[model samples]
Target: MDTALIVGYLASICSVTSFIPQVWKIFKTGDTAAISAKMYALTVTGFALWTAFGVMRVEWPIILTNAICFCLSGLILIKKITRRAR
Candidate 1:
């Protein structure tokens, strides 16, 4: 692959995993007080749009990266909502 594609992949990897630490912390500590529901909701919406855009353009890196991000953000959103419900 070319340098551009390699860079894209590297960037995607970083973007996708950036949420893992937050997820892990939330999971381990069960603390959603610091996590803003509105922020994550907006983030998930943005990621969904990006994933759709990548799908329309047939871009694997964007699609995969945004899809993973969407899921991660969705997980956080769900946790926040459910905790709020309780």
Candidate 2:
């Protein structure tokens, strides 16, 4: 792959991996109290939009990154809702 493609892949990986901190915190501490439902809600919304945009633009890197990000963020959102209910 070219340098530009490599950079795109790295960028995608970093963006998707950005969810690791939140995921680790939730799993290790089992504490979702500090997390805001609204924020995650909005984040998931934005990720969905970005994913759609990536698809429309035929940008595989962006699509892949957003797909992983959406899943990770969705997991946290679900955890937040479940923990809050308990």
Candidate 3:
């Protein structure tokens, strides 16, 4: 109901879904040659850390969004690593 809370939700939704396209593209076409392993590794790690922090703080929005982001980034990271091995 507050403006800040509304903004937080909106921002979280946008950030959380931002990885969907990348994950979908990587799996759909099996093309991860251009995806940087370091970048995604850092991203997933960062999201996991943020999710933990959110959980510690008991912030539902942060926990929910970062958890989603962690999973999505983890998916991409996994795909990139596996593709590079082939």
Candidate 4:
């Protein structure tokens, strides 16, 4: 296998897994007090755009990574928004 491919896969894994701890923390403690909804909203939007761009370009890595990020960030953003409403 190519080193570049290995690096790409590693990066993708890192990017995708980075959200796990935050999600787990939120799930276990239900605390989003310090999380910024606006930041996450932008993050979700950026990931959504990146996913779309990846789809248009037929890039699996970008699509998969950003799609996962989009969903994870969207989850956080939703929690933040809903928490603010309460």
Off by over 4 Å in 2: none
- lDDT string for model 3 (1-78, tens) is 888778878889999788889888988999988889999899899999999999999877788899999998898888
lDDT of 4 at 54: 90
Per model, state how many residue pairs clash: 0, 0, 0, 0
Off by over 4 Å in 1: none
lDDT of 1 by residue, 1-86 (tens): 98887887899999978889999888888889998999999999999999999999998889999999999999999999999999
Best by TM-score: 1
lDDT per residue as tens, model 4, 12-54:
8999999989988997888999998889989999999999999
Tens digits of per-residue lDDT for model 2, 7-78: 889999899788899898898898998889999999999999999999999988889999889988998999
Best by lDDT: 1
Q: List the residue pairs that clash in candidate 3.
A: none
Q: Is candidate 3 or candidate 4 better by lDDT?
A: 4
Judging by TM-score, tell me the better candidate of 2 and 4.
4
Per-model lDDT:
0.93, 0.90, 0.88, 0.89
Worst 10 residues of 1 by lDDT: 1-10
Model 3 misplaced regions, further than 4 Å: none
Give the local distance difference test score of model 3. 0.88
* Best first by lDDT, ranked: 1, 2, 4, 3
Candidates in order, TM-scores: namely 0.96, 0.89, 0.92, 0.92
